[model samples]
Target: MSVSAYKRVQRDLESPRSVERRIFNRITADLETWGAAYDRAESKADRLSALKGSLQLALVDNTRLWSLLRRDLSQPENALPPELRAAIISISYTVDRITADLMSGAGTVAALVGINRPFIDGLAGISGAEG
Candidate 1:
């Protein structure tokens, strides 16, 4: 992925499917695990709570985002970083690529999900903020 193509790839993801579904599933699963882990962190309770709300928001966002991606992924080719920050960018990039491929309009499941170009861009922007 070249820098110029990054946006194109991101654009593609907006259309739907490809690798987005798999990636979204992974993200959802990871968030669930993370939430549970946070819950279990007795020693770090204070720290976790302090940041847990943000973490939970991110988790919810991941769930909503994953829902969109999965609908697309089921169609065809479909797809993280940071202590949490790196994780966000990494996930965004992977999903962007997968979504871009789906945007090419080659798969059948594309219509199932309603990921638009703005959504992908928003994800990128959100990820950048975290990064």
Candidate 2:
């Protein structure tokens, strides 16, 4: 490969901004995939049965991601403002609560997916996702 391309690759590997973008992109993709799965399951004969298993798995993964994000934001050197950190941590708690509700048959994946939309947009720097 050319030297310029190689240097870009090296920067992508080492730069925290790029790393954060990748993480956000990955999370967004996962949410989209899970949403699609739910949609498909709805068309099946045993949607509740299918959804229970996969939904639990997906919610568990989402909670784990939120847990990690909360841990990071709670750190002393996170660079974000205190208010923003608190807000994000608060959102994580809401996610946890909503996840519990969904697992208990009292909520829908739509709630979890909706709450996480801003994280995808804010983290990926997308001002308008609909366009």
Q: How many steric overlaps are in each model, in order?
A: 20, 0
Write the residue-wise lDDT of candidate 2 on 5-119 in tens digits: 9988887676665565566556556656665555455444444454565556677778888898899999999999999999999999999998776555455667777877667
lDDT of each: 0.45, 0.71
Candidate with best lDDT: 2
What are the per-residue Cα lDDT tens digits for candidate 1 across 1-131? 79889977776766444344445555555444444544444444443453345445544455467455445444434331214444444555555564333234222122212233334445445453554
Candidate 2 global lDDT:
0.71
Q: Which stretches of candidate 2 lie over 4 Å from their true place?
A: 1-48, 128-131
- The candidate 1 region of ten consecutive residues with least summed lDDT is 105-114
The window of 10 residues in a row where model 2 has the poorest summed lDDT is 42-51
- Segments in model 1 whose C-alpha atoms lie over 4 Å from true places: 10-15, 22-26, 29-37, 43-54, 66-131
Clash pairs (backbone) in predicted model 2 = none
